[model samples]
Target: MELTLANVMGLVRQTFADPRGAAQVVLRLPMPLQARWAAVALMAVLSAVLMHLMSGLMPPAVGPDGQVLPAISPFFWAGMVGFGMVMTALLAFVVGRWRGGRGELADSVILVAWLQFIQLLIVVVQLVVLVALPVLAPIVEVGAVLIFLWLLVNFVAEMHGFRSLGMVFLGIVLTFVLAVFGMTILLMLIGVAP
Candidate 1:
């Protein structure tokens, strides 16, 4: 594809019309490598700043070294959004690229943001659960997270018209299981996470 402003704008427009399909194209193909690097850098910078800000929001307790605890605030939420979108964008790219595609980066960002919006819906429900239905928090939160992850991954895959839903499902399940396994192994080695 010719790299022009029109093409970029078209990509953006096409992405909006059918984001999941457009995303699959971007994620799976061997597209221009520049966007990947750009995305990763953006993700890293945002992640670092957001992590710092979010950490400040935590309810602090006395440390073993006798330091005063910290407090968690509602600041830096946009940064937190940056952090989340970057993560989903990476996931979209990896899963998309793995199956062979050369899609645009902007589309990937859109998918990331769209999925993030869905997650926000879940968060709203979780918040309501906390306030009005405290006993349901764990169930709602965990179920919503798992369902959202699968749905987002699948939706992103569907966008690119590459990896099948089954493949995405297997990929996600395998990825999750392996992550757990790897963490378990590492923790076992270090005497953690039983």
Candidate 2:
């Protein structure tokens, strides 16, 4: 069956709301391979675009003519994709091993990349909503971090196994919270991101 854009968007929403369960859903589809392939492709494009947008939200780029422009740097984009791919593959191996999931490096790379795409989409939505109504900015940003941590926990389970999913979930929650604080401190020290 051909996957539609609407179906992909729904999966993206599901990924944010509940990633492990979402993974299960993806795994259970009648045509899991096709669905998975479509998801992986969509995610790659989304991550590329969203990474650029988020970078823009950070340090606003100034054009050579002194006009404000979106921060557009090939290095930054490369970092985004490279880091994402590496982490995804690593997590897939480690987590799949832990869970006895038999996830190959290539498989992990594909799934994790797609997962990041879902993650960036959520971030973009938060950024847009926060900018439109600044009062909710803090809530949205924190919420985005929580969702990521949740994904981390799910990825851990994907590798290790389901027995410790709850523990992994707790770990994700704590680590993510700590990461937020850690990242905030780093940003404050650096002046700002761009």
Candidate 3:
């Protein structure tokens, strides 16, 4: 299928209805490995740009000490997001293989990038809601979280050819916990507070 605007919208709608099927469609896209990585980078940059724009619309965050925390730069967020996408793909490939999964790194990369794209669309909707109906922002936030988790679980299941979504979800949660713990330990080792 082509990457036209109409196709994307259709895919988004399909994703909401059947995330695993949408993931299958995404994985079937005729893109090379390098292109998949490029898509990941592009999605990261796009997401960061939207985040920067949204931050400008919202009030600055206040720390526990009542001091306003400095806003992060878009470039910094973009780099972090790109690194996250790459690492997620790598971990999914390596860990999935260890668990008898039959997915490739390229498939993981494209799926993650597509997930980011879907998130960008949700962010756009949230931005619109925040501006037009501020009271509904909380509802949108809740919906976004649900959509993200739903899509992630389905995408992982599709990528690894797993039949049980419950198992995929459990694995995702465990991996997330381990990743956070590892990151915390690494930060401590480097004398940085998480």
lDDT of each: 0.59, 0.64, 0.92
* Cα lDDT tens digits for candidate 2, 1-194: 13589877787777777776566655444544555455555565666677666665655767899999755665556556666556555655664565456655555555565567767778778778756876787888888777676776685565444557777676545655765687689998999963
lDDT of 1 by residue, 72-189 (tens): 3334554555655675566566666676744455567645654554455556566666668778878996897776666566665665555577776677677667656876899999
**Tens digits of per-residue lDDT for model 3, 1-194:** 99899999999899999998999999999999999999998999998999999999999999999999999899988999898888788878888888899999999999999989999999999999999999999999999988888898898888898899999889888998998899899999999976
Kindly give the stretch of ten consecutive residues in candidate 2 with the minimal lDDT sum: 27-36
Greater TM-score among 2 and 3 belongs to 3
Of the pair 2 and 3, which is ahead by lDDT?
3
Off by over 4 Å in 2: 16-18, 25-48, 55-74, 95-101, 158-160, 169-194
What is the model-wide C-alpha lDDT for candidate 1?
Answer: 0.59
Q: TM-score, each model?
A: 0.53, 0.61, 0.94
Question: Which window of ten consecutive residues has the lowest lDDT sum in model 1?
Answer: 71-80
RMSD of each: 7.9, 6.9, 1.4
Off by over 4 Å in 1: 1-68, 75-81, 173-194
